[model samples]
Target: MTTTTSSLLNIRPNFFYDKVINWFPGHMAKGLRIISEKMSSIDVIVEARDARIPISSINKKFEEVANVKERIIVYNKCDLAEESSQDIITKAFEKYRNQKVLFTNANMDRNIKTIINIAANKARENPQKYPFVTVMVVGMPNVGKSSIINSMRRLGVHRGKAARTGANPGITRAVSNTTIKVLENPTVYLIDTPGVMIPHIPDPVCSLKVALTGGIMDHLSDEEVIADYLLWRLNNFSNFGYVEKFKLPGPTDDVNVLLPAVSKRIGALHKQGCLRLSGT
Candidate 1:
């Protein structure tokens, strides 16, 4: 919410919401290339991921890209996830790399201090060429990389925001740098990279989950498909709140049967886009 240090030229498609769809665009192949190229100088690699879907949200090739650097996992938006699940995920991630895992809510500025301390200590102990501790934050879109930077700036630096934040995808387009000095001792410079999804996400369920969770652009997804996948997941979990909420007679796995009823109940006459009523 603070003033950004640098203005991000975030371009978004402002088109009419009338029955138009497209595949996921803005693949930042260059972003990954930059991360790989810049990893040589980075002391610590902070992989920011959504706390809700810890394992699914992380990039597939992160281990390969960040293999050389000291890695620390920062599970952002911890407030939305269960504390018990966070503990399990943290422990599960321990074997991959002997690293400290931190769960943080950048929005609330909670547990962010621990993130800075862990990352800073790791950087300082490793001894890099850069005088200050150099840390690069990487994650898929909408995973809260920018918010984490702002959180660090607020508590550690108490200054302006280094990276831009938005509710939608593509808020961060390029690599941005802003240095925040932690009050304690080591001055850490955080480099915020553009959110980069894997080039080829092979699993359909994984792709749907990512899109539904806002990791990918909404326009790139079929609304019906997203909703259908969501319904399937809800059914699989044995959660039938939708049946009552939508005023359906009984639980139905069909999105078509449920979407129109809810749409009409909410006085939404144009029940076309964002949800398909027909079972075509």
Candidate 2:
């Protein structure tokens, strides 16, 4: 939706401050330590990722722990991200023959079943080497890691949403592992891990935007820049009504115009009838 500088300022404060600052907790460190200890038992690593921002969602430390293990990258939340981005992510991971990538929407029970089957088939391919296949589920917070596990447990029997789901990140906190025997040929054990939030490595503002907005597009300087950019990109789509509803003025290409426009919309004014664009 297109939001004016003033309106955005009114709705959200601390325009320059980073949104949802994330830090690695002691529990996460303990979980990682546990995963490391059991790394040898794992036959395959199932890495779950947010389809919207695959790169940002992945935990960098995973590569070190997953060294030399068969890995499968599952792109969750396909319904939210654009189809083109999905294709690009899938193709990018295709280069690794040992790593199988699949796109799925955890909310849909059927899709989750299919993913389980795909994971089973891939695990069974090299059965002679490893008799028991251990699959470790890893992903960022709120990426549906727990939901995927509960769905698999129901075996398509329960359709209702049972796993804890929310917009606020870092809901899953502990690691839960279980075993499932498929067709008596391959005994697969799946490990569900707590969501891990890898600290952002780049611009703090950009990182905040992703945490708050749930997706990262082109970088913008301020709230106005973000709103304007979103408006321009979504204008061609059928959802441009937000622009008119908010009565926001058309945005200029310049980033300098954003701060003042947002300040004015939010009534950030001082005693002299001038806009208080800075210093709270």
Clashing pairs in 1: none
Clashing pairs in 2: 5-261, 5-262, 6-262, 6-265, 6-266, 7-265
Tens-digit lDDT string for candidate 1 (83-110): 7897688668676657767888888888
lDDT of 2 by residue, 1-280 (tens): 5544443322222344444345667767877877788888877777777777667677778888887777777788788878888667766766655567777776665366665565567557766775666677777676667666666655633334335656655565667554533223445556777776564545564455455354332232345555544543444343545445445465333344544545556778676756674455
Q: Please provide the root mean square deviation of candidate 2 (C-alpha atoms, Å).
A: 7.8
Q: Which residue runs does candidate 1 get wrong by more than 4 Å?
A: 1-27, 122-131, 177-184, 265-267, 271-280
Lowest summed lDDT window (length 10), candidate 2: 6-15
Q: Give the TM-score of candidate 1.
A: 0.78
**How high is each candidate's TM-score?**
0.78, 0.65
